[model samples]
Target: MTGRVRGALAAAAGALGFLTRVPVGRDGDAWAAFTAAPAAAVVPGYVVGALAAVVVAAPLAVASDLPVASVAFAYVLAVYALVGVNNLDGVADCGDAMVVHGDRDRRREVLADTTTGVGALAAVSLVVAGLALGAVAVAGTAPFVAVAVVLAAEVGARVGLAALAAFGSAPHDGLGSAITEGAGVGTAVLALALAGPAVAWPLLAAGSTLAGAASGAVAVAAAGAFAGALAGTAVVGAWATRRLGGPNGDVFGAATEVARVLGLHAGVLAWTLS
Candidate 1:
């Protein structure tokens, strides 16, 4: 029992480590083990996300009675701001690079520079605002559930990028490679499975609300939404591949953030309108 508990805890640490650069230093001595423990990283990232949810949701719940929708939006803002905001930065950078310029070098420059440009400013603000509004509108009953969808998508994106970094590695050295070395196709698939529900369940609930169990039609809607989620990730991944010839830490961060929000929004919106 103790061993099982420890194993779970380690995996959680690994997950957290995978999300942030903290795990690499923490597990510095065990280079081989840390690099091979991909599932471990997922655990920590999820835990961190869950903790952020409590902090964000608790205050909104206590301070005032908000509509589920409002709280849902707040939760997203809080979660992103608290620990996952790095990914938000990625989205903003990607947007700025993709929109304001054409050349690959310029795009990479936009991504690498920590400075904010007009394009980056607009993209980040708009996205964060949309996420906050979406959550607030439907936060009443399923705020946490919605957040899970986001985090799950985050993990999925991470898993995919993990595979990308591992295989598409250039003559570079960074933490991204370390994570890729640790991850496997199995881990990536599991991440996708975890991410899949974020869209499907809320979709079913929303459909049930409006249609009262006509799931056949719900299946169609769910499939479309899921496809959109995939498309978002693919777009980002392709850009990263072309732009850098391989993903760097920045690209990885950007992809994860974009996919997570896209997944959450896609799921919640499907349910909200269903």
Candidate 2:
């Protein structure tokens, strides 16, 4: 391969290695090389991961003997397995940090504490419950729609993560800082562009149905959901900046989890209302 091709390959591998637990081999030293590439390149890794989720969920979704809850639980497990539990740890830290009544320093201290508090407990509960409920709702839908919505929601979640990284300031010279520090608006825009089709796929699926006027409504809902996913990310990023002094790895994790749930609900609501 040419040098440029080699770099692209390495960056892609870096993205998978960094974002996921999947082994991509250590030949290229992906963890270190990952930081060298623009974070936007990692977006594709999210797409790949989301696609895997869809594939895994499809069989369960179409199976007559399977329960929706089982499918949802499996889907959630598959995603967490692929993505790693590191972000969930962030949710716990962010929760504790948010509930602590103090300035940024105090919150940061709480975030760094290894012990889980009531706040952390509540945060994990809410996040896990939300994810399960959202997955169940999507799984209850038609196979095509279920796959589309799940795919879109996962993609939107990653886009939200990238947006948070791009728009929010880093609290310190930590992982969040390293990832988000130099990310520009262009990176966010690129993430949205990649996410757009995934978000819109449900609409296309809905439109292809013979439901007439309801088709239009589903399309509109899909659009609204997509817009909401993006808007919610910005709002959360700003909130984290104000409340915590800036975004951290925890905040990014929280934002991504929030975005996925929002996207899933938006898609389901659109389908229901239509």
Candidate 3:
């Protein structure tokens, strides 16, 4: 392969390693490549989303009579299994910082503090609950449609990360700076291009099993989910920039969690309305 292709591959591997519990791409070289390319952050979503989708969908396919609550629980489990609690920690940190009534430095200190405050407890609970509710809605859909929606939501979550990495400013040396410092608007556009195919995954997945109307609805749902994910990401980025001076690792993590939940609900709503 060409040098650029090899670099892209390494970056993708690095992103996968950093973003999920997968065992590959942890080496220093892979990480270097990953941090160098902002678009790399978008590639791993396919792997993660596909894996989570299968984990949730397989049981439902095998046992169609499974309770919706059980399916929702499985969905939540699959997400934590694939992505782990690191991002959730980010949600907690951001939550604590957000509720603190102080200047930027004080809030930044809160972000760095490891103490589990009431805000952290509340934020994590709301996120977990939101994810479960989204899964409950997904369970009500056709199997293929459910798979599409789940996949779309996961990919959208990653796309949100990429968007923040490209456009967000970082005030200190940390994970956010590692990405934001190396990325620019061009990289952000590339990230969006990489994410564009996710919108079609639903239609392609449903082509053989779903009717034309259903397939179209799935398409609308996927698009809406992707849009919603970006919107959620923007909200977090804007807030972090104003309150904490810029994006940080915790901000990125919070954005991912928020984006995924919003994307899931948005997809279901679109599908229902369509």
Candidate 4:
């Protein structure tokens, strides 16, 4: 392979390793190299993680006899398991930071603490429960539809992270800081562009199920969902930046988790309306 290709591959491996427990290489090189991976480079890692979730959930979803809660439980477990718990840790930190009454320094200190506070625990529980409930709702319609929506939603979450990295400024030196600097507007646009089709396909299938609506309606719904999710990401980035004094690892984590939930719900709502 060419140098660029090799570099990209290495970065992808690194991104995946950092994002999940999945073994990428024989050594720790990829994880070490992950620090330099750009926001765009990490997009593929998100795809891999999302695809893994789809694979795990698809079987459960397809089993018509399966309970909705079972499918949801299985799917959520697979997603967080594949992506690694650190992502949730970020969510917890951000939660603690959000509720804490102090300046950026105090918030940062709270975030840095390893102990999970009441606010952090509550935030994590809410997000995880929301994910499970949303999965059940989506899966109730059809397994295939649920799979597609989830696949898209996970991608949407990562896309939000990329957008944040591309557009938001990081206040301190850390994991998010490297990404913020390395990932440019071009990368953000590319991440969104790549994620659009992923979000659309599932919505297309769901929309087709509605009477009087055809593929065109699917197109409309998909477009709306994708647009809505991006808008949501922008809003999250803006709000988090203001509240947290710019994007951090915690902010990115919280944003991704939030986007995932929002994307799934928005897609389902669009389908319902159509």
Local distance difference test values of all predictions, in order: 0.55, 0.70, 0.85, 0.67
CA lDDT, candidate 4, residue 40: 41
Tens digits of per-residue lDDT, candidate 3, 1-274, equal 9999999999999998888888989999998898899688787778877777776677777877888788888878888888889999999999999899999999999999999999999999999999999989887776766777777887888878877888889989988899888888888788878887878865665655463346778788888778878888989999999999999999999999999999889988988888
TM-score for all models, in order of appearance: 0.66, 0.85, 0.95, 0.83
Candidate 4: residue pairs that collide: none
State the lDDT at 117 in candidate 1: 80
| Cα lDDT, model 3, residue 11 | 95
Error of 2 at 113 (Å): 1.2
lDDT of 2: 0.70
**Candidate 1 backbone clash number:** 24
Global fold similarity of model 3 (TM-score): 0.95
Q: How do the residues 160-203 of candidate 4 rate in per-residue lDDT, one tens digit apiece?
A: 77778787889899877877877778767877676766656645
* lDDT (C-alpha) at residue 138 in model 2: 72
Identify the runs in model 2 with alpha carbons over 4 angstroms from their true place. 1-5, 25-29, 36-57, 202-207, 210-225
Q: Which stretches of candidate 3 lie over 4 Å from their true place?
A: 203-213
Question: If both were scored by lDDT, which would come out higher, candidate 2 or candidate 4?
Answer: 2
Error of 3 at 271 (Å): 0.6
Question: Which prediction has the highest lDDT against the true structure?
Answer: 3
- Rank order (by lDDT, best first): 3, 2, 4, 1
Please, what are the lDDT tens digits per residue for candidate 1 over residues 1-274? 6965755556555555446645333464344444565544444445544554564446554654655555565566556554556777766776677675556667777666777788787877876776565445334434344344444444444455544544545324676576665566765565555545533554545435332324433443344344444555677778777765666666666666665556556655565465
Query: Model 4: runs farther than 4 Å from truth?
Result: 25-62, 200-232
